[model samples]
Target: MLRPEIARSWWRSEMSGLSPEAPNLRVEPDAVDRRSRLAAAAEPVLAELAEQLGDDGFCVLFTDRESRIVDMPIGAGQLRDRLEGLGVVAGGVFLEETTGTNSIATAHELRRGVAVHGEEHYLEPFKRFSCYGHPIIHPVTRRLVGVLDITCDTGNDSPLLAPLIARAARDIEERLLQSTRRAEQRMLAAFQAAAAGRSRPVLVLGEGVVLANPSAVELLDPVDHIRLRELAVGIVHRGIGSPPPHTVRSVELASGREVSVRFQAVAPGAEGVLFEFDKPDGTGATARIVGSARRPGVRTTEPVPGMPVYVGGEPGTGRTRTVQSLVDGGRTRIVTLEASEVAVHGETAWLADLESTADDQPALLVVEDVQLLPDTCAVRLRRLIERPGLWIALTGAPLAELTGQGAALAAACPAHIDLPTLRERTEELPELVRAMLDSLGAGDRLRFTPAALAALAGHPWPGNLSELNAVVRAVAGHRSVGDITPWDLPEGYRISPRRRSMTPLERAEHDAIAAALRECGGNKLHAAKRLGISRTTLYNRMRTLQITT
Candidate 1:
């Protein structure tokens, strides 16, 4: 006769195909982000709890959202070693699916405090231990940050374990709230100091917070705020140590007025950037800051006198936009046609549209997704691209990867610019995230914590810029104002991959194989049988895919 929660956990464990006789206690080594806001908040609290628990056999364990042990501050040397042998040390995973029913996993699963003792454990290996666990939810986002657990031998189990774990969890949550409040306070103080006189337009920008002096508000519109923010974000990402000398940038506002902005950090250890704006003197040579246009890692092609241009990159790498930027007057000076329309509108209609657009205007003729063009249409298009006084540009896959007539069309364009994938441009993520927020109209109201930015950088953005933009838009819609923490990110984005990213089909196959291995307690032969693959094939796939059992 067990408690209802324990009975439910046992049922889930059985359904997970975990064996009561021999549990799968092996855990892989994971590199946790020590700079995480959650980790920062919980470390001190766990340390204090550890001293109180002492060498009295009780141990305190802190885990991240994924249930990987982040720290074990209280365990004795012998006990710590024993747990390490069972993969319970720092950086080791203790999820229910992998480790069977226990307090840490069960508390996370049930979203509450839980206690498990003696034979009540789902697996025999865990039967001699007693544990109390509680999930720590973010005070603002109300998302699970991690879990706190207290464990000891059953013989040394104390009635105080449950209460102690709950208190520690609450303490971590409170610290998280206080950390956000303190950051906002520091930003406000810095803003006040900078905006005291308001001689010129002054603005302080931080996560979920924006401050503007009266002069600033009067001189700027919503669009101006975004542009100024982009400039600040770019400067900050370049590296903000001791307050660097103010740098001036000429930026065009939405109202069509160009202003020179002075940018610097708000304060050391503060979470925002400070900006002051003034009209530029007509004589001073000013460098223009054009948001993502000036961002690093994105290659730009200069327009040749009469030669056509070719811009190539993966989808969402801003191919068409890059070409438009090269023309004298941006998109206004370009007549755009999508080669992909050849499939829907038929090649004849598509070709006719391209010819008419090229003949009708003196504008630059731009063909987008030219890789999708039919061979016949592509061949005809090459002639139009080669015509004198008709400047043309093509945006699509790299020239070397193109085939047949498409390759010929690209070869005719003498100027080529290749853009790198988003993953290769991780150093630009901070500025890119801010610029995107500005474009999405949330720049002034939202900012990411350094920890959150680090988490984002760790991901290998397989979907490139489009995926990143979608994730940012989704995260933006949820929080109106305040700094975004890593916990606030979507769960999938938060996952630190243990291996290289896989395609959807490969991921599904990988998941099936991993599940089978887990169900069979890491027995290769049995898992292979369950997955309907030979053991030799399983071994080869495991090696090729970098799956560790």
Candidate 2:
């Protein structure tokens, strides 16, 4: 009898118009490359499993979640040909949608071990072999990454195939989880180092939070975690120009005193915040902490009035600041039009004033979020584009994205510059941060450690300069005055796992297990025999080497 789940999956396949009579052997090359990491990691484990079934007439198959055959090693040549003839070789797709309900895809669909024999197979071509498959689950995430299968002629079916495939999948999961444990350990160590010597509460952001020395972790409610993450993401990357006053403003703890927190970059999306509550040393004179201030990266010349200017960038990317710098030394009548406003109201507000202006007058018209400029506004704006003594600056999405409909608007304002994200300007970060701090009056008071700078540079800045600016402002406002170490930054940034050194015996065992598994075609039984140890002993050692299945 077909299992209820298999029956449903078969129905799903039928609904999708898959015919059981026709199974194609076409392989997707892209799928193989996409699963390179999984294949590389599972190579030894697969070889070991294949060795154990060496003469047992079972062929091992590995496939990605898409059911594209990634790797396979067969026992009997004739059986291999039979199965390969039915689209069972590497690159063959076996999902219900592709090949109808079969063990490899069905077990993946069920996300568990399953043994399908003869008539249980939805596709007639697959009924030639009995197959057992188990989904290779991600240990940390508990998501199915791929499937492991053992296939044999119907007469060679054994109850042990399910357990064997399941164990192999578990083995793969264990290896995957090892990486997670290593990452978590590094995060914990970094948090510990950064949190040391600080009296303030230090919260490290990641997939979850890790608190440092003085912080009472219990005080942080689950809701606070969500709120803090949202605040951090919004402030830097989410196009939020500024954090709400309630979020960045000092919060009054239950102790009847206000505590100010500084959010520093952990990675990019993550942040570590240091809290300062009623510190006797609290003496910040500036109401707005300094973000990065440019020391004129561009040498300014006198603006030739009537020269068309187009400034373009995402929100908070120094485009407006650059424009202001260009107009600093002159009396250019500046009029700003927010394209978003125009787009919303369906009209440009400054068009009347712009129309009345004398042609020879020196003027700067800045359009913010110019990508939002409507078709009608683009038409009106074009009329003013060729006016004498007028300069137009624009900022918005990339020109390529604007080409479809906003091409005319772009053509109207010819000068274009694309601002690079913060990740692209790591070299400038240190100087920018320091200069901004000096301007904020904290240059003499604080310095960032090499580790801190390294952490900052490594971040993939999704929010660009604005996020970095917020980070600098935060550090100045709340960080303890001194060299900013990696710990002083976010926990995520400080993560560096200590390299583990294996003992001589462990080294020997690792080498031996690896060699034995290879020589035995990954058959643990023969490998155990070759190593002169019991199969269980071999299993234990493979686990030690992280190669067991």
Candidate 3:
């Protein structure tokens, strides 16, 4: 009679579309994590096991959580060649779907120890050997870290094989436990050192752990704790080599009190960030506190009658709005002309319309994108500027950047207003975001958490107000109520704006995990499914990446 487990394994393999005649030996090069905690813990144990099995014509296979073989520590002579030929070598993926039923894939599928001998093997190519596999589980997380397998020639089966691999798996798990304990100890020690003398609210955050001084505990409410934890985790992941130094963010707590939190890593390899809180300066300014420099300012010269006024800024810097604000409310008649349309409508018609609008009545004429006008039109515009009853304003790039007709038109204007780029005006992010939300009619239903606003402040805002508006619109589309955290922002914005050291692979993995979480609305299980990794693997990666829920 077939064992119940083997029968189920065979059925699963068949359902996966694998043939019994041959096994798939394909490898996923990127699936293996050589530096994973599991691999590191298993190294010495596997080396010891390999020595004990020396010259025995036995092969030991170790695979990562993804079922890709990472090491073949004891594959000797002909056994190594046979395993390689069968796609059982290092880097090969041996999932049940790819290789049919075998000890390695079957143990991974069932999450238990399994043995397959001779004819019991699902594929014909594996009939010559007997194998036993045991899963290595993390002691702390109970996550399946990897599988340990040993294979020998048919009829050479010793009852000892199963127990031996089982023992090896336990040994690896123990080492993982020790590693976790050590990391926690290091993190705690650093936290203590930093918090020992500090009077202000201080806290250290790491994977699944948070340590806070009494001051922090008292100052922060429960909701504040969650947001602060998430913020620290994000920084740890974005930070390179050592913890980012002198990084500070101003955020409003759940209790409606705003504080500036200075962030610094506890120590290298500690995997925790220290939060030192302080009240804002006397002025209570909360934005752009990360750097020390003069704040950006908008400059404007009073508009003079009979002489055109020029408004200059980047595409999204509110140039047109600024120009419109100059007119007396509702009473002043306004006429507009777009110089960019001259090409499509013909310069004569455009110039004729400008002349007609100026002569029609006493009104303000606004010319947009004036840089697109021809030199002849500039002469016409200059002549129009002299009209006694007509007031004209030209809006386009800054005065210094304009040339030719645009330059002449801008210089002819007696008064000028120069708008600053969004990056230069980050101090206004909070009010700007609030005003935008109000415009979207979401102000009463949704609001950004302080950490979210801080993240926005760090961005360079290359697109100015327009890009910020688009982002707000996109976010409002998905959520209608409650606080919007940094986790809810799009992937690109979630990254720390400060530059730090990170390997390419690390950065890619970080981005992928962050994006998945955002798409799933912070659902870890769903995110893991979207990423094609098990929940346990996802948690491990999150901890490694310093990502928190």
Candidate 4:
């Protein structure tokens, strides 16, 4: 049987070109000197190696970028003088050509382990020492940073020593990688915590938001994180199309400096697009959520008791506000988890947006835009709903198709509510307008004339409640009290009688199904309930309306 030491020596000799004829003895001088130099940051590791390798058996050395001996834990003795004479001093740098027989020089050049035994040193003095060494890498960046080496007199060189050194290097690399991953995790946690309870501008690229932090949001124009990503994509798309003189580029603020943005495409199979932003200034601007107007006849309301309720309507229909009201009312503890944010949990606990939250505690899991939930998340949600305690709510706009997943979601819920658009519920215009004005502190003092109310109510509010709120606020801020009129409304909100046309009943049915689907959180079963019909009837209506599901 091969003794562990002999096997190690043989392996090193074969792999590193070290000679087996090297002297077999020990040198305490070099080893003690190396240990003392390593006593600062690497003391524990040096001590451990010493205890395991025996006195004078092993010495640890640290090298700089130029492969110069920066520190070492080797003892002072005659052999040390011989090694020093061989140009192994603190300032002596080594390279493959310069130190032909040194393991440190060879390992640094080859980016691998190396061993130099007796007679292998190009210089006669170093022929008395045998060296084993490996390159070190940055813990986080994974870049080659330095080297660690162990050396002993040729007389003490043993076969097992090479393998021991290699094992130690491998252990250190593993620790470095682990530490890097942990630091990344901590940074991500801090960012998320800072984002909580704050309305930061966010731009969703593909799977995750590229700039969701308060600083990023505040510095950029007011745009939803998702919209920001879309804008970025649009810019890229435009750049590809027109080939403008100034290439469309993203700018990021880092460390109180503005820098151009750059991105490298990740593998197609990667979870999300990786974006690197330019460094910005340390100080960040305040962030605010930009919103549009509500579409006509769109109504918004918080969910009530019985079973969990989902309210669906077009964008700017006040879905966020409705959810916020529920949270404020103590009806539920709302955890609004956005689908665009990528959060990595352990493999077993990993979940997409709709599937987040493993808590058994009573709370409302509010997912925005159910249509965007990844398939994995949807499936996870299905499983979660099987158990009790938690309520799931979602919001989204009209989907062009609702098959497979659309059908699946339709069957999952029991309650769904459709919010009427502003156009459909024009009779409530005065009330909504008044409420919005009062909320803005304008009250009855800042009233709109009948003509202005009529004009506002007549326009097709493509943005729904959100649009109405903005118009009211704008009029309040810009128009003098008791002088509000139809002419006071923004140019975009002006009504055109010629544009009005009655939609066919089939079209109405389609709209109702689509709206109900959104309200029911994309659950067909709950949509049917909201529509006051059986699931079969809903399916039939969907088919007749030429809706795909």
- RMSD per candidate (Å) reads 10.2, 19.7, 12.3, 26.6
Question: What do the candidate models score in CA lDDT, each in turn?
Answer: 0.74, 0.61, 0.76, 0.54
Compose the digit string of candidate 1's lDDT tens values, residues 1-549.
Answer: 988888988876665546688655435454564656677898899888877877787778888887778877778777677676677877776766557789989988888999999888887877888999999997865768798998888998888888988998999999989987887787788778877865777887765567888877766654344445656653433343565556888776543457878877655534567787773344453434322353456555555645798888888877866776776665356678888788899988898888788888656788998889878888888888878888888899866688877678778888877777776665467668888999989999998764576567656566788889998998998988888877789886764322333565765677688788889887776787898887657755765555654
Q: Which wins on TM-score, candidate 2 or candidate 4?
A: 2
Off by over 4 Å in 4: 1-306, 324-328, 342-356, 360-362, 398-401, 496-549
Report model 4's TM-score to 2 decimal places.
Answer: 0.34
lDDT of 3 by residue, 126-153 (tens): 9899999998887875668789999988
Tell me the tens digit of each residue's lDDT in model 2 across 1-549.
567877887776664345678753346665464324456557778778767777667788888866778877555777777877777767777766567677787886678888888887777878778888888876754657789888888998889878888888888777766655654665566567656786555666543334544444534332244334544553322222444222345543322234566664432222233332233233442222122233323222223445555555555667777676556565657767676776455474545544554243446777677667667766777767776556776567655567633667666665555554455445456667777788788998888754466566555456777777777777777785886766666554453211122455875676678777778666655777888897556644654445432
Off by over 4 Å in 3: 1-271, 281-307, 328-333, 360-363, 387-389, 420-432, 447-464, 482-549
lDDT of 1 at 45: 90
**Which model scores highest in lDDT?**
3
lDDT of 3: 0.76
Question: Which of 3 and 4 is ahead in lDDT?
Answer: 3
Candidate 2 deviant stretches above 4 angstroms: 1-18, 27-81, 90-98, 107-111, 117-120, 136-146, 152-160, 168-306, 311-334, 338-363, 368-391, 394-549
Supply the TM-score for candidate 2.
Answer: 0.41
Kindly indicate the candidate among 1 and 3 with the higher lDDT: 3
lDDT of 4 at 104: 79
Models 1 onward score TM values of 0.57, 0.41, 0.47, 0.34
C-alpha positional error of residue 294 in candidate 3 after TM-score superposition, expressed in Å: 17
